[model samples]
Target: MAKFYELQRAMRAMRQSALQRGALAILDLGSTKISCLILRFDGLDPSLASDQVGSLAGQSSFRVVGSAITQSRGIEFGEISSMQEAERAIRTVLQSAQKMANLRVDHLIACFSGGGPRSYGLNGNVKIENQIVQDEDIARVLSSCDCPDIGDGREILHAQPVNFALDHRSGLVDPRGQIGNKLDVDLHMLTVRAKTIRDLAHCVKRCDLELAGVASAAYVSGRSTLVEDEQELGAVCIDFGGGSTSYSIFLKRHMIFAGSIMLGGNHVTRDISLGLRVPISVAEKIKTKNGGLIVTGLDDRDLIEVGGETGDWEHDRRTVTRSELIGIMRPRLEEILEDIRTQLEIAGFYELKSQKFVLTGGTCQTPGLDTLASRILGQQVRIGRPLRIHRLPQAYSGSTCSALVGLALFAADPQDEWWDFELPSAGYSSRTVRKAVRWLRENW
Candidate 1:
């Protein structure tokens, strides 16, 4: 019951505030870039019913006012390393985005990537005194859940229920008003090191803006990347950012697992920079333009002219085979996928039996990534892009924009966050638990 009351309170507060207009910023604190987007929410337009903004599944109706990205200076592995440096980088991006949008944002929702994210699947049950589940009962059951003793210096990132069941019939999308004696819930909780969140909150607080919320990059990525069917049946979204790759699994339209690997596109570039003795800039260019896992018949003959700073002819004309370049890139890519595979396995991917997978983020755009990923993941893998939105900038409409677009969606209609809903008591659990579990086991 406590959880439900908190959820209700949050919803009430949000409804009262309405978050109608002006500017709101979403700061993506990444290892490679500190991106800030300044969005001006045009007041709801009834004439355009399609554009209404609220928490509705598969419904979006917001337009971007401005967006900007800058190189991150004080972040490593997606966590803030230096507050001062990160603050400066954030200011730069915010200033540029505000200038372009002609708006100043007082509210911000920040997304972060690191701090050793861990996922736990929790089940809570309550028996209803009566034959039906009530709001209070729902709240009581959630409160009954013995909140696990997360290690010291750790904080919960996401603790939302992924699936719910009532009585012996599972797959109950919504358990409210159901004629069931018991209630059962399958929840996915994600946690991160406490210091990571503290640093992020501290940095943003110093920026002179109110922190609306903090979200996992992987969770937001899945929001924009996974198609409706993929989300419904279950799918994993791998976000290959510059500094780290974040992963999230969704089943029954709710996020069930989330994690991140320090290895990312930056590691690949570094490997190329060192292996080929090329400048970092040139290595990045090569990775972006010619990097791939699959080497073919014509690759050996293709030669790349290395660019030089001092016009030094000695280092500028070193030609390397495409196969060699692929050789350098392939292993690192495989390692990332292998890490993801391990993460999925740990999170019970085999039990899900989901054959759909989606890859998104800036690094995922590398040539031949889809083919390579398909070979490694052994699933129907595809590169994913942000869902198309009206008035989104051309530059922010690609796979890399998944998190950004999803941030907007989250603001417009956030799912029942941790503090959103309540749980039922013993009465409800006794009536619903076994039946619901049995139903889910059979359906799944």
Candidate 2:
């Protein structure tokens, strides 16, 4: 636990340094596409005023100085499968973005969709030392949380104090400087496969770029797609990516749960390729051009040319009705939705105050997906796109870029995590805590 917090503190320090330098890169390492966005900050302190940092962290001021999107290679299900190929792809995108910006970036904050993320809710309380909450009190309460044994081969990705309480008064966003005898907190800790993170970090290091921070694509997608009210009340944001569909639940403007299914749009494309005996590339094109969940009488009469590169002329000229295409696509989509429904049930989503579901990401572009999701995942479903950022191109301001855009907003004004507090030297016994304190002192 101490090591995890130390790592988070180091990342936070790196992020602050990047902000002070006025330039940072946001990378979305997905299964199908790797996106890079070079943001040029105005060197303005986000803490200039509360009102300025209240919503979207003054995102309107930061501009995307450079951007690039390229096909991902040697990655599957959001994990790097081949270091050499993934490194080459990262270099390709970074070079393109740097060229556009006419400036090179050495620090990057990256988000990825895969990692076998698991969320845990923890509660902690500590008596106020001086009858008023202070930074030390906050840190004590946070440190009081008894982290569950998440087992080996996993590491903490996000440890956030979502709620605070002072004596009988609960639902406090921040209890500091308040008169209270006791401080309480509800924390959400997200853990992911250790190997997945190590590989990504190694890949970034090999590219000669410092990894300032890393985030789960699912959580960032919710940050970009879910509106303020939806996040405050309650909502689920499902990011349908190429090789995975990740969903996160938010309540009171904090993520409470996050999970991902390995199946996604790539499965649909592969289904089409295998079922129709077409090349993977052709199947992808067909899926993009003609994919839909709804079929009508007119679709039966509408024939789509499924051209093939096979030597046989007759085989190359075959056609299939839109209805047949829908038949091949619907089952796989339904299966994915059903799996998401099951996960939602496990998360107790129905009990939330507002059960709104927002669908976003590359695959959610399918026609009638909102309606289909409403039926399969229940009502109150809607398609979502990333919130508009300063000078973001129309081409990149879609659902597919939600994670990348959110990473920018997050980089500007991150949530108050455990490391944001000052821990008492005597409270922690681990040698790791001493190292963390020293690191924090040096970084700050």
Highest-scoring model, TM-score: 2
lDDT of 2 by residue, 267-305 (tens): 999999998999999999999999888999999998999
Per-model TM-score, in order, reads 0.88, 0.93
Clashes of each: 35, 0
Residue pairs with backbone atoms closer than 3 Å in model 2 (clashes): none
Best by lDDT: 2
- In the range 1-444, model 1's lDDT, one tens digit per residue, is 344345445643543253554467878888877777776666554545655544244233455777898889999999999989998998888888888888777778778889889887777888878888767766655565556667898877767767677887777766778788888877677889989988888888887876776788999889888988888899999999989999998888888889999999999999999888888989999888888788898998877665666667877767788888999999999999988888788888757877678999889888888988888886599999988765678888888778887777766666764344443233655548789989999999
Q: Estimate every model's Cα lDDT from 0 to 1.
A: 0.78, 0.88
- Lowest summed lDDT window (length 10), candidate 2: 43-52
